[model samples]
Target: MIRFDTVSESTLMVHLADEIDVSMTPLIARLVGQIQADFPEQLIDLLPSYTSILIHFHPDKITERVLRERVQHCYQQWQNKPCSTQGKLIELPVFYHPDVGPDLTALAASQAMSVDEVIALHSGATYTVCAIGFAPGFAFLASVDEAIATPRHAEPRLRVAAGSVGIANQQTAVYPAQSPGGWQIIGNCPKPLFNPHQEPMTPFQVGDQVRFQPIDRQTFHSLGGEIWPHWK
Candidate 1:
């Protein structure tokens, strides 16, 4: 069932599901495309999360009541059409070590596993890009291996470097740019995730598949990765 809630005079949030499930990615992706195709003139923007989409529309172009009706119709048409989850698969090279990822040693200790074990567990699985928010190109990739899953820090760091890969509960993500954050840092990806001047802007999109490939320190530097200053 889909529920529509008023966010503002021009914004309506569409709740597709109550929980965050990876299966919902395809629905959310398709719905975004459908709404854009169906009402491009009236839509200002759309922000998708794990279970909902924040829709911004032009109030002058479409009334709240009518817009809701149109969106619901679009949802109904695409809801059961066998959408594919096989979006683009992007491989990210990560340097999993202590210098860039300050919490690596502590996180390993907490799980009673060696740092290499933690790294392997993290890099072994293919994850889905469920949502993108917090910053441009900051993608929320889902379901870190259960053995290596860890909680966010009780206190967020004042600044987390760009490309820092971290885990909070079942989700893992790379800090697309340097920003204050709290997710447990495990490694750093050398790829520059967001480039405003670039065509796609971000390498990640909702429903895309991501796999972290381990790399050594020298390779990390060669790829243009900066060493995050060690926390005092």
Candidate 2:
């Protein structure tokens, strides 16, 4: 069941489900595409999260009543059509070393697993991009293997470098820029995930598939990844 709530005069929140479900990704993508195609004039922005979508629109162009009606029509149309669960596959290379990932050794020790075992488990499975938040272009990927899953640090770090790969509970993500964070650092990716000058800005979308490729220190630096001062 879909529920709609008015956030403000020109904003609407569409509640798709009560809990986070990986299956909702493709459905959310389909619904967003449909709405964007149908309401090009009135929509200012649309933000999709784990279980809801927040829509901002032009009040002058369309009233709340009319907009809700139009959105409902689009939702119904999406429901009637077939939705694909697959999204674009993205393979990200990471240097999983103690020099870059400070928490890598500790996490492996806590789990009673060897460093190589932890790395294998993390890079073995393909994960789905469930949501993008915490920072621009930071994608929240879901379901790391249970054996290697770890909790976030009790206190967040003062600054985590750009391209830092981390895991918290069952979710994993990469820090697109240097910022304060609490996720357990396990690796660092070399790719630049966010570029302000780029058209898309982010390579990841909510439904995209992500696979982490483990690499050596040489490849990491060769790809423009810098080891921060503390890690060195």
Candidate 3:
């Protein structure tokens, strides 16, 4: 079931589902596309999260009743259409070593698995880009392998470097910029996930697939990846 509420005079919140699943991402994306196509002049911006979409509209251009009706029509259209399996598969190069992954040793020990086993489980799974939040270009990828799923730190780091990959429960994500975070640090991805100057500021979008490719410290340095000195 879907629900709608007015977050503000210009913002409307559309709840498509109660849970966060990869299957639901495409539906949300399609709805966003429909809204953009149908009401180009009225839509100021649309923000899609794990289970809901927040739409910012020009109130002067669209009435509340019209907005609700249009959204409902789009939702119905999304439901009647077949799901599209096609999505971009992005491979991220990650360097997993004790020097960068502070929680690696402890997480492995807790799971009764070797560091290599942990890395294999994490890198092996193809995660879905469920939502982008917490920071700009911070793609929240879902369903990390159960065997390696770990909880976040009781105490978050004062500063987690950009491109640091971390796991908290069933989700995994990379820090787009230096910020305080609590997710268990597992590895570091050398590729910049976000750059304001770049054409596609974030490499990921809703419903995209992500795979982590492991590399060594030497390769990481060659790729211009640097570990924050504060971590050392």
Question: lDDT per model, in order?
Answer: 0.90, 0.88, 0.88
- Best prediction by TM-score: 3
Question: In candidate 1, where is summed lDDT lowest over 10 consecutive residues?
Answer: 223-232
Candidate 1 lDDT, 1-232, residue by residue in tens: 7999999899999999998888889888877877788888988999999999999989999888987787788788878788788579999999999999999999999999999999989999999999999999999999888888899999899899999999999999999898899999988999999999988899887889999999999999999998878453
Model 1 RMSD in Å is 1.6
Consecutive 10-residue window with the lowest summed lDDT within model 3: 78-87
Off by over 4 Å in 3: 80-82
Which model scores highest in lDDT?
1
> 108, model 1: CA deviation in Å?
1.7
In the order shown, the candidates' Cα RMSDs to the true structure are: 1.6, 1.9, 1.6
> Candidate 1: where are CA atoms >4 Å away?
77-82, 230-232
Query: Which residue pairs collide, candidate 1?
Result: none
For candidate 1, the lDDT comes to 0.90
Q: Candidate 3 on 1-232: residue-level lDDT in tens?
A: 7899989999999998887777888888777777888889988988888899999999999977787898788788667677774569999999988788888999999999999999999999999888888888999998898898888888889999888999999999999889999999988998888888988899888878899999999999999889777873
Off by over 4 Å in 2: 74-82
